[model samples]
Target: MRELVFALDYEPGCNTVADALAEHPAARVRSLSLHATADRLWRVDHVTGTHEALDAIEDAFLTSDYYADCLATEDCGATQTTRVLDRADNTLVLYSDWERTPACDSVPHIAQDNLGDGVLFETRHEGRHYTWRLIHSGEGDVAAFFDDLAGAVGESAGMEVLRTADTTASMRGSNGTQSSPSPEQEAALRAAVEHGYYESPREVDVAELAEHLDVPRSTLTYRLRRAEEQLAKQYVAGRLVTDEASISR
Candidate 1:
């Protein structure tokens, strides 16, 4: 359950940890700049290296732009040799507060998993700790995961404090559950707010907003359309338009 955002333009630097993770052909790192849920947040995810190779990965995230705005959460599997890393270790892990560990299993989840490495999995949350799975690789992946998680937690804390520090955090999950945006979405909204796009005059085009969001305008439109339909149904039922209006359309 570790997550956060980093430079979309990121490349492995000459750092020791980065060097090692780069050595592994199987190592995979995917960085996504997504729209934040509920509060408009930004998040990044990295997967790479053995436990011995993570010091470099940690270094990269600690210095990334999102680090200043996030608080990471860390969860080392039972066998973790390193004592749990705290938030100060990395703030990018903050994007992970939304995950939950599933019940134990017997079979290998990742068929290609190396025997020497025990699998570790952590769920992620974008808004209020929703459920998304990042399955385990092996013992080799542990160190980086823990380090990444610590960063994730710290980042999450920082974000929560910035946007909702004065307000209580809760998810309205009743069918009344509104669109729960991920941390990525929240980040874009912040940018728009700073740029004066989220204004009464409608300063920013929806497409511009989507570009700033790194998401398709169609996707955002669809989501908003759905949200509007739902809200209209729930809050504006029989008031805004009637069944006769639907027939007219």
Candidate 2:
């Protein structure tokens, strides 16, 4: 399968949550999922740098043009439910449902038209642009999807294809070799080491690491453990191969 990652910028009048995030530098929408139903539901997961920023986000949900557009589209009824996942880190998770509305011109709808069963793995809002990671069955589908999306959104809104790669091949080195540590694994290991996660004094904990990586704590911990296992296995394999060669000689 192929994974195509791209960034799409909303037009000036096409207000979206991304636009709301652009207005708050201390806030970021980490991930979001849209469900197609009688009431179209959008589950948004986000992190804020401060309580004031969090309050601003809640206010935006109520007053932003994004929700107004949804309400205007097909006489949709809009409602939102929010929860505090982590008060200390300022993480907020919310679900917004637009009842009896047509699909908003959003990334999820674009993927549905193009990729069929493609999965949207990650989404982040930076400035006025929203970056999306989608996994498609093939390259051709992605290309077609891009064309269709451009046609739908018009030329005024900038669309940029940032990166594309085969899911299976991306994790492997050249010539199908298994590298000691994958890029993500290496990054997790480096962060852990640099932050003194391994030190007796423990300069940084798993929560801190997760915050730094913008991932869940469990995710960061899993990657670090996987990286350590890979490094250990590589060392043992190398030693075993050398010992066998010496014995033969």
Predictions in order: lDDT: 0.34, 0.60
State the lDDT of candidate 2 residue by residue for 1-249, as single tens digits: 887766666554455454566567547766656454333445556656467766666665655433521413222334444444444547666555543335445455556666775454576665455666777677347667788777756654567675577878755633233365656678889888998999999999988988998864534654676577767766777787789999999
TM-score of candidate 1 on Cα atoms, chains taken together: 0.21
For lDDT, the strongest prediction is 2
lDDT of prediction 1: 0.34
Per-residue lDDT of 232 in model 1: 54
The positional error of residue 239 in candidate 2, measured at the CA in angstroms, is 19
Writing each residue's lDDT as its tens digit, candidate 1 over 132-175 gives 22333223443444344434333322212111111112233224
TM-score of each: 0.21, 0.55
Over the full model, what C-alpha lDDT does candidate 2 score relative to the true structure? 0.60
Candidate 2 global TM-score: 0.55
Error of 1 at 203 (Å): 2.1
Error of 2 at 47 (Å): 2.2
